[model samples]
Target: MRSFPVRLPSGTRYWTVLDEDLAVVAEADAFLRHVRFGRDQAELTTRTYAGHIALFLRWCARTGRDWRTAAEELGLFVVWLRYGTKEATGADRPSTEAGLVLAGPGAEAVRKPARIENVLTGVRQFLLHGITEKAVPSQVLALLYEVADDRDLPPEARGEGMSYRMKARHRVQVPRAPRDRATDAEIVALFLACRCARDRFIVLLLARGGLRRGAAAGLRRQDVHFMPDSTALGCHVAGSHLHVVRRENPNGAWAKRQPPGSGQPVPVDVLVVRAYDQYVLERMERPHARDSDFVLVNPQELTDLHLRFEERGGSSTPLGRPTAS
Candidate 1:
């Protein structure tokens, strides 16, 4: 089974699951479509959910177990998720030939606890959606969740009474690690290593501006307000800031949803402003960039740069084809 990308006539894209025969799995397709359209989730969300669901379905098929029955024995699945090799888990073709070296007791587990937890979360959601569609038995819910009371909750969370909640039965305990941040020296090194003003601006935007790669790439020329006061541009924001508005971008870049009542624009420092100025000056030298409204324009050379960055464990910000003007 595989996760397949689908594009509609209206240019909306999403992901669905395909069976071994390459036919769309109807149940998986319906659930993923609801996740993409009905729940109004990002397209990437559908892609992720589709991949996880496909894995579960493929496992069920290979093991000759019905999906509903597999839910009851999910502990086995968890073991498989942890220690099963790619060939054993049916993620790769089975080999008939003997290997030169055999895996010993010291072989590391296939997946981390956190990754297994994510897979279980997707599978549980898929099963719940199946229940709503009358395709799964209601009894499976008992196997998946346990009822718990709020007796151990804090006073504020108890809410004046003994409320109950359904807790998931299957969960992996993941260890928390300290969040890592780039040092000043590392940031300076990255900035100095950039070959062009555009690359340098991208480095600063990610390091200092606290902008995600997608949000930084999705920025439009109109979103930037560099002056101390921008009343003339009709923006009420006081300082040099960038508005991160959520909309469908041609490059498939999406800003994460902001919290309610927190619509303030992100402020930028003088250094970032200077970097933007330099980038703008360099961008104007390229005749193709003159007609584009987006703040960042990708050229063929930049596309090659993106590949190298990704190979070096850095994420590529650009998602669309190189555009001229």
Candidate 2:
């Protein structure tokens, strides 16, 4: 309900509060800071971990139980996480009706199984951190580790994805969808929806080259090699290719799981190269273009033709992949 602001290295701020008057517990706060500044984790990772841990802390506070001594309560915690408390259930109701509900009709929105699993993972990590700190009791850890029988597992939870050692003590039954290839009509509709050559090129890089949005967004002009025998970079790839590197740009794009040195090279189809050429020659040289190394730049025109226009990298607005229905 209320938040205490925490600033990130990236100059972005996020609040760390469980409820109106309840900030994250000291142990949880220590774990969060260790993950943030100590391990140098990204802002997103820190926020996610803090949020889940805060939720668990809030539940413990409301239930009149210490988080360290309340492993068995997790069984009930999972139910409240997915379905919320029932009127028939003898669980203690919240002191205030205005508090955020985890799940139920009173909840602002529903959470998918994957989302629930992620939250559980964060709590698990928090407990693990406590174990390392020697703060959590071994009995509590063992209790949380207890698993249910195969027969007890719901139909969705019975299959191969279940962990044998861990069992099903604190797991949610997530519905899995069968993977289907995109149809020809779907692919056609995707390309037809693109408004410009830049858009088409970005889509092609994501679809064909298998480049993530961050990788595509971080690309530099020097990374794109259109020449088979170039005097400039000296390497011949026989076709147009782009190298993906881990570089933090002004626009806030970064390649995930990138190694220290040498980037990955991916060859582009001829049509993708044509799109690149069109975007570079016709669109890039427009008076609005900025003098930046980033490959993707968006232009903003000045109302007066005599005035200079503005152009910048696609950092502020992430160029997301076009979904093929």
Candidate 3:
């Protein structure tokens, strides 16, 4: 099975699962559509859920077990999820090796505990959705969750006391790791290593402006206000700042939803402003970039600039993923 992207007449996109015969899995499609339109989730969220559901469906098909039956024996699925080879999903490839050849100690598990947890979470949600739609037997809920009271809860959580909740039966214990952040020296190094003003501006925008990748990429030229006072331009906010607005970008970049009473523009430092100035000069050299309204645009192609940077490891460790301040 594979996950396929579907674009609707309204230009909204979602993901669905397709079997080996290239037929859409009816149940998976219904659930994913509900997630995308009914729940109003991001397109990427549906993609992720579709991928997870596809994996679970593939595992069930390969093991000759019905999805309902597989849910009852999810322990075996968890073990397989931890150690299963990529080739296990393919019909032509063998699932096991004949002999063990020692590889170096640096080898890591096929799937990390956190990733496994995410997969299980998606699968559980899919199963619960199926139950709500009356497609799956209600008895399967017993295997997936356990009802428990709030007797051991803290005072704040207890509320009025005697309240009960259903807890997931399957969960992976993931170890907490320190949040990775880029140091000042590393940020400087990245900025210095950039070959062009655009690249430098990208580095500064992410590191200094505290903009999320999607927000930075989704920024429009009009959203940037470099003037100290911008009453002439019609924007009320003063100082050099950039607005982070949520929009449906063709490049698949999406800004996070802003909370109520928090739609003010984000302030940018002098360095970011200076970098933007230089980037503007460089961007003007490219007709395509100059014509595009987006603040960040690829001079050579229309692909997502932030995603390209991520693919080139520009957002990797030591320069951990940028987040809004």
Candidate 4:
């Protein structure tokens, strides 16, 4: 659409503004911000959504397809995600059609099932958002819910009339292998490997108490109470307990489930209490110990010790996984 000079009856000339295509990226960004601030989702969550949605938009732009009206091609979108090839070296681009499945040079890399599923879910959410914002027409929005898996429902409950046209949303997701838990012997060996009080205490804290690494790291001095009755304001638990507090810690640890300003009490065994006492009385009082409220801090990299302690606290961040045998 071009703007032409319009002659006015009173000898004045004027040009009308021409409309252009909507900026998809800008629109997507606005939607992302709405997701971040409006939905109160975590930074990492919003970032993942942005990455997935951006790929879909990029694929649409590269393939010259109207993403708004491409509901019928959703299956094709999944296929393209798995085997699409772009002609770039530094970064790979998404393509519409599949090329030769070569293992060597110029071959399109196939994505894992999980990754493809994530991208498709992101695209689905984006289209739904478009419908809510009126960027996409209401008619096309019906395609989003066109797939329904109601086989488990009673025969009378199923919408027999409208359900025929509705296909299953996507393929079944790939099953992941079960994670193996650390054995009791392994836990004992890990505890034995620690040379210092802090390291030993951290290991005991996780293996015995089943505290996540972040929860352990986020612990404060007030959180640990060896005595059954403590003077701390919020320490009302019966046994010797350490509270997992969600705080914006000076050090970089965070509680996973406990929101900021909340706390979850976890009981500790007598052995764990002894370890805590040893850490506080003997090792933590060392002159070189960093002045921080965090329960676990490395006086030195314990991984460099004689036993070569390669456990979580010694070398890097706490392993966080529960030690379940």
Candidate 5:
């Protein structure tokens, strides 16, 4: 690379502009464009990450703080963030950053919590990118590796001072996911224990349809449809197929008798419709109750029926499985 002399506000601006590195920058731009187009990331996520990376690059250039020098200046960056407003105190020198004094919760740094937290993570990622590209020093990478998890940082170091800017990281805890959904054996075990006709169908519907309890409860008498293409329907006459639902538009009907929006055809399993149909005629609908459409609730006139249903129980309602386990 040859230095080129140019006139600037600071007199002679001599720069060693390399031709090869321009191609690298162009490639990086193309990669970001590809990420925007090719992936399924939400628009906001893509924008946020891109914006943060841009800020990191700008900061790196302004401070002449490439990855190699970042390790020596890590403490300074932390101090600059904690205090040192440019308008009041002027541009902070590297040496001046070391003895930064944090006063209280009333500090300027505490004002923008979300930006402060995100910037820390963003800068860390930018430094990592430098390491991968072999632009950063090995010492910076080693120090990054040596830092304890933020949650494990010493209480003494955390005592309000420059040390409060501990290694910023997300605290990881052991995940407690939801308990075992009915396993095949559990479903079988439950079904075997039940003698009632409706109860036997319930287990099969749950396993086959993978229906949530709320969706199951939302079923109605009118939801059942025949797939047989038969004119005359007879009771107990088995057909190869049945549709559990023919969903209408949100307004309950469309001009063309289809849903208002474009929707996909989800075929209902035969066992599920058999189950839905059985509940409607036998359990839910008496002669007077037939007017109401809901399969789960009979329309028998009763005050405060809604209140009773609301108070029934949640999905996590204890089933006494703890004793056996």
Candidate 6:
């Protein structure tokens, strides 16, 4: 067991955590190995993806690059990634105990530099996810990529006597913008005209609260609780605020319910609680064929909201009342 170095943003020696049985890298690798694959095999197993992510984080720690500074200093960290992997191995894999010490000088210098490159790529992707989620600042994101150049995704496998051209074909698409945000005006307007309690609540939660749409969509009647007895509540609304936190598979579509990020409770003001209560009461009055575990019904009561928007524009309004167009 040996520890590797990491630099925290505060300028403290974050310390080397990869050592013996207590190695952080080893634990992370083990955690990733048993990850479950959802219905979509094309998507990486959560654990597998996480394994790549840890390789990056440990390297960043070793190099003293904050999440914000990673883009520019990534190459330095990338250079050392292979060494970290060689130092850490699981029972299921071939031993890499002497991986670094045994390699020739040229191999040490050029030595599967591509593997390290892939790890850096993985970290960049993870940071990008964090940025969109607001875990990291966008300025750091711009600086990190403002200087990167590469051979795209390097290959996962290589051949003994393959053609040079064939070798270069394997590459990964770098992180691209996949998330789109509603314009502030659009978001603000949605809140003003939203007649449905569910729609109105989700809009505010996302914009003002910075919550993801998925998190809002997943809220359940039980998951929501109100704070009572203070100015926090009125008599009709009682004495409680909406408790916002992680929930079961909000829609019950996925095997597990809690979203990728974390969760919490939101105590809406008096007006919001009243709207939610109204939405629930009205939802109970309707008789739909499908079952809903949701606190908010598909304004129109459609079973699938994703497809409802694409295939059935007629039901776009979610009860003929769109979230402000």
TM-score against truth, every candidate: 0.84, 0.70, 0.79, 0.63, 0.31, 0.35
Residue 19 of model 1, lDDT score: 89
Q: What digit string (tens of lDDT, one per residue) describes model 1 on residues 217-287?
A: 77888899999999899888899998887666777877788644423389999999999999988877653
lDDT of 6 at 123: 58
What ranges in model 3 sit over 4 Å off? 90-108, 149-164, 231-235, 260-264, 300-325
Candidate lDDT scores, in order, read 0.81, 0.64, 0.80, 0.62, 0.43, 0.48
Query: What are the clashing pairs of model 4?
Result: 213-320
Across 54-105, the per-residue lDDT of candidate 4 in tens digits comes to: 5666555555678787765777677667665443210243232333222456
Clashes of 1: 0
- Number of the top-ranking candidate, with lDDT as the measure: 1
Error of 6 at 5 (Å): 34
Best by TM-score: 1
Clash counts for all predictions:
0, 1, 0, 1, 0, 23
Please write out the lDDT profile of model 3 over residues 1-325, one tens digit for every residue. 8899999898889999998888999999999999988977778999999989998998887777899657888887777777665766433324446111223566556789999999999999999999999989999999999998888677878867478999888888999999999999999999999998988999999999999888888888788899899889888887988888877777777777775442548999999999999988887764334446778766555234445656787742222222211
- For residues 181-266, write the lDDT of model 5, one tens digit per residue: 76778877987896654565556655775544434444454444435542354423234332233232222221112233322223
Give the RMSD in angstroms, all C-alphas superposed, for model 1: 7.0
Model 5 spans with C-alpha error above 4 angstroms = 1-40, 82-107, 147-325
**For residues 62-86, what per-residue lDDT tens digits would candidate 2 score against the true structure?**
6667888766778676665666443
Model 3, residue 129: distance off in Å is 1.7
Q: Rank the candidates by TM-score, best first.
A: 1, 3, 2, 4, 6, 5
* Residue 67 displacement (Å), model 4: 3.8
